[model samples]
Target chain A: MTAESERRTEIMDAVERLLARGGVNAVTMRAVAAEADVSLRLVQYYGSTKDQLLGATLDRLADKSVERWQARTRRQRECASPRDIVESFFDEALPTDRESRGFHRVGVSLEGLAITDPDVAGRAYQKHLKELADHLTGLLQSDDRSAPAARLLAWEVMGLAHGLGTLLMTGQLSEPEARTLITNYLERLGPQLCL
Target chain B: MTAESERRTEIMDAVERLLARGGVNAVTMRAVAAEADVSLRLVQYYGSTKDQLLGATLDRLADKSVERWQARTRRQRECASPRDIVESFFDEALPTDRESRGFHRVGVSLEGLAITDPDVAGRAYQKHLKELADHLTGLLQSDDRSAPAARLLAWEVMGLAHGLGTLLMTGQLSEPEARTLITNYLERLGPQLCL
Candidate 1:
């Protein structure tokens, strides 16, 4: 990577760390500089404002999340069923590990920001949702030709996964309980998937 | 209301307003005092600290949310079915209007805080989830005779509603689309609700 690009990644990484640790309120230009071990001027050089920095970071995070899911799907056997795809999504989306937990925190933070700040973070959030929805919809469509509402199903799966992730992260639902819930849901959805 | 209790409610209303307008970060003791039109000393006299104030406000919000759902259920015809209960939940949970939108924002902010500050906000968030889950589960159990997994189903409904709310609030899904998605979900879930 070029030196400039490397510095940019370093700064973005710092922003992610701050967001994970303290939500959106914790992220600032000075905090990014301190976290990245660079000067505030250097941080500003990369992103002119906090909103710009956050927007760029959210864009990068969104892309990385989609890429991660794609990689997971690729690792699975070819022609994975809708159930398998959804199970894999839950397995990845749930914050069972520290890394996944941090990612979930960042996601919740972005979600909160998307509601309040519709310009930068909101747009980034919408793009993230659209990309994930499209990817999941395409996978489901390929797996089941007879299912006419694959797109809606994809959105349902995405919504459920995101909500369950929050419940898991917040200690509302245990991991085993969440898994069982998904299993039961899939069992009920089995016939629909086939149709 | 008594003078003391009325004062407490006033302070909390100010907190909720601030939370709705700008999220958790917008809330502080000084800001709360300013919003409440009270002395800063009075604010501290009531809660002692920011965490205390936030915790109390969350507890009140949780209670109010549960109460709101109860009132809705009571207003419905006697013996509302599982589908009816779930539909009512979505109707109330979605941030379609200004008041509901503000409430949703406060919810997201609390959710974000529950991740970072588990002691104060996290406990409150869990209580909120538990109360809602219990309420919904009980309603489903009363409505259905043979459904054994009512609790899990309640969580599923809550999760989906929440995730869908975020999607709607973020403009990823239109109101009509969300309604149709729920309708599709209910149709698929109809057999299970009966069984």
Candidate 2:
């Protein structure tokens, strides 16, 4: 990568860390500089304003999350059934571990920003959802399921994952309990998928 | 209600409006005074600190959402099956109309607060989930289903509702699309509930 692009990536990385540690309230130009271990002038040079910096950071997060899912899908391409695909996705999406919990924390923060300020972070978040929906819809489409059915199922899974993840993160549900819920959900859905 | 409690409610109402319009960033002591047309001293008297104010607002929101769900459940008490209860929940939870959309916007912002600053708002949000779970679990426990099954299903439905609500609010899934997705999900889940 070019030196300029590398510097930009470092700055975005620092922004993500700040966002993860605390929500948007914790992010400031000075904080970014401190987190990135760079000068304030350098941070300013990389990201001109807070909104611009946040917007770019969200765009990068969207890209990274989608790419991660795509890579996971590729690895699981040889799974035996649609049910396997869905189960694998739940396994990955649930915030059981520390890293995933941090990711979900960032997501909830972004979700807040997205809903209240649709013009700023909303566009990036929506694009992220669309890309994920497109990817999951394609995965769910096979010999028996039509594209529309796949799309709905894709959304259903996405919604469940997101909600269940939130519940787990908030300490309302234990990890084992969440797994049990998913197991029952899949059992109920298995026959529908003719698995 | 007493005069003092009435004033407090009005101030909180203003906070909700600010939060709905601009997330957490828009809510300030001065802004609350302006929005509620109350004196700044009155706002301070009602809510001493920003965190205290936000915590009280979230607690109120949790109570309101749970009470709303309970009222809806009461109206649907005679529904023949668990599937009906789940369907009724989706109908109520989705942001299909303006009031629900505003409620949802408030919810997303609070969810961000809940996850990122758990000490500040997590307790109330968790209480909200627990109450909703208890209510839904009661609905699902009938002649055919056991308490364990009912509890799991309650959470699954809750999770799906929260996630799909986010998707809908964020404009990733339109209201009609969300309805269709729930319809398909119910169809798949029907026999599981033996409806």
Candidate 3:
């Protein structure tokens, strides 16, 4: 990549770190410069306003997360059952590991910002949710399950994943306990999956 | 109620309004005084620091929400099934109406504060979650469902309620869509309810 694009990428990375560490409130322009190890002028040159920078960062995050999910799906065999897909989804989505935890932190931060700062961050988060829902719904739909059912199931799973993830993050539930909960949930969903 | 207690209650009500309308950042000392229609000194006298005031507000909110749920449960028949309880939970938890929407707004703000400001607000939010979880678990447990299972189910329900509520609040899912989703979930959980 060119020097300019690399610098831009570095700036976005800084924004993500600040967001994960201190939420939207901590992501000031000066803080971004400090986090990125770039001068304030360069940060300004890359993105004129904090809102613009945050919007762009969110857009990039949305793309990257979706792409990562799709790439993971593509590597799996075509015969991967709906059950396998869901089990894998739970495994992938849980915020157990350090990397996943950071992602979850970013997610909750965005969720908080989305609710409180509707004008600046809300549009980006909605787009992120829509893109994710559409992607998951497409993957979940099968000949046995109706499209609407798949959509509803997708939303339910997304909601559960998000909520349970939060619980796990906040130390409300342990990893083993969360796994058991998911297991019980999957057992209930077994009939629906025709498994 | 005594005049002193009444004044305290009014100050807390103002804090809740500010939190709901503009989140934690909007609940400054001067803002609370203005919102409460009282002098700054009165606000300080009620709660010396913002953190102290917020902690008191969260404690009150936790008690009020749990009390409301318990009251609802009391009005139901003794023979109200676990399924009924879960269904009622969804009914009460959904932010479709104005009051519920404000409650949800306050909840997300607190959740955000808890996650980011663990020093000041985190303990209070966790206390809120634990209290709610314990109460729900008590209601959900039965002879057939083990205590562990009941606890897991409670967490799952709480998680779904919170995540779906966020989706609804953000306008990603309409009220009808959220209702349909819960209906589908309840149908799946019907067998587990053993009714």
DockQ of each: 0.78, 0.84, 0.73
lDDT of 3 by residue, B5-101 (tens): 9999999999988887777878899999999999999999998999889889978887888887778877884967888888888888888887677
Tell me each candidate's i-RMS in Å.
Answer: 1.0, 1.0, 1.2
Q: Lowest lDDT 10-mer window, candidate 1 chain B?
A: B139-148
Residue A10 in model 1: shift from native, Å?
Answer: 1.7
Candidate 1 structure quality by residue, lDDT tens digits, A82-176 = 77888888787888888788888988988888888666876787888999888888878854453447788888998999999888888878899
Those runs of model 3 whose alpha carbons end farther than 4 Å from true positions after fitting are none
Residue-wise C-alpha lDDT for candidate 2, range A1-195, written one tens digit per residue? 999999999999999988887877789999999999999999989778887888889888877876776677778777647888788778878988876776787778778878887656566677778988898888889878889889899999999999999888878889999989998889888876662
Error of 2 at B99 (Å): 1.8
lDDT to native, each model: 0.86, 0.83, 0.84
Q: What tens-digit string does per-residue lDDT give for candidate 3 at A1-195?
A: 999899999999999888877778888999999999999999999989888888888898778877776677677848667776777778888889876776777777777667766755668888888888887888888887778888888889889998898898788999999999999998889878763
Residue A168 C-alpha lDDT in model 1: 88
Prediction 3 global C-alpha lDDT: 0.84
DockQ pick, better of 1 and 3: 1
Cα DockQ of the candidate 3 complex: 0.73
